[model samples]
Target: MVEQLSRREGDCFLLTPNRSMSWKGNIRIWLAAFILSMLISTGMLLVGAWPVLPFAGLELTALAAGFYYTSRKCQKREVLTFSQELIRLEKGLTHKEKEWELPRQYTRVWQDVPRHPWTPPKLHLQFRGEEISLAPFLNIDDTEELVAILEKKGLRVEKRRRPEKLWF
Candidate 1:
């Protein structure tokens, strides 16, 4: 999701991934799967297959962990505030884990075109020879929208084509 926040300080852009399922919906789905798996595992236990119970528990645990990680990832975001001469970036999941303030004139926006058509292009902010990826979870359209916003703000965008060679 790309949202523009109205701010007196500067133009603010909030970048977050779009998640189709709400937490409540996710919980309900996981609960249903849990109940079904437990019922089958318990039925196996009664049939003298005790090992199925532990394995079921392990499988459910793994499923719960994956769900939790995905939920947390959805909470991640990047807030970019472009002032007249400076750019502020606040990135985190729920809280500001990383914040950067750099001179807008010196910062350059970079877009890397991937060789494969299935893969989405990458966007990054280059400052002082170091590059920071910008909203990696954004899809192709949203990525292009971000680039448009950056260009509108007068940030120079450099496009790069990724190499096609596969090397270990």
Candidate 2:
């Protein structure tokens, strides 16, 4: 998702991965699945097919772990603030945080495309010989859209390089 905050001095762009399911919704779904699995496993156990019980428990455990990790990742965010004199990039999750502030004139946004056609391109900011990747979770289309928006807002945008083909 992309959001713009307008200020008297400049603009702030907030970007986050789109999450179809909230943590609460995920928990509800998990609970429903757990109950259904337990019911089926208990029925099988009563019918003398008891081995299904342990497998059902293991399946639920794995599902819970997967949901936990996904929800954690969904909480991460990237914030870009562009003012007259400075541009700031802030990205992090709950446990760790990173921030960079650079002179607006010295920063340039570019797309970094891998040599392979199958790999997706990435958005990056280059400043004073240091390059920082932005919005790693965004898909290629979304990254392109973001680059367009940044360009429209007066930020310098470098074009993606053409991928090279190899003939053997």
**lDDT of all the models against the reference?**
0.90, 0.85
Span of 10 residues, lowest total lDDT, candidate 1: 159-168
- Using TM-score, give the best candidate's number: 1
Highest lDDT against the true fold, candidate: 1
* Cα lDDT of model 1 by residue, 1-168, tens digit: 799999998999999998989888889989999999999999999999999999998998998898889998899899999998999999999889999988999998888988777776889888898888889989888888988888889887898976677676
Model 1: lDDT equals 0.90
All candidates' TM-scores? 0.91, 0.85
Local error of candidate 1 at residue 159 (angstroms):
0.6
Lowest summed lDDT across 10 adjacent residues in model 2 is found at 112-121
Clashing pairs in 1: none
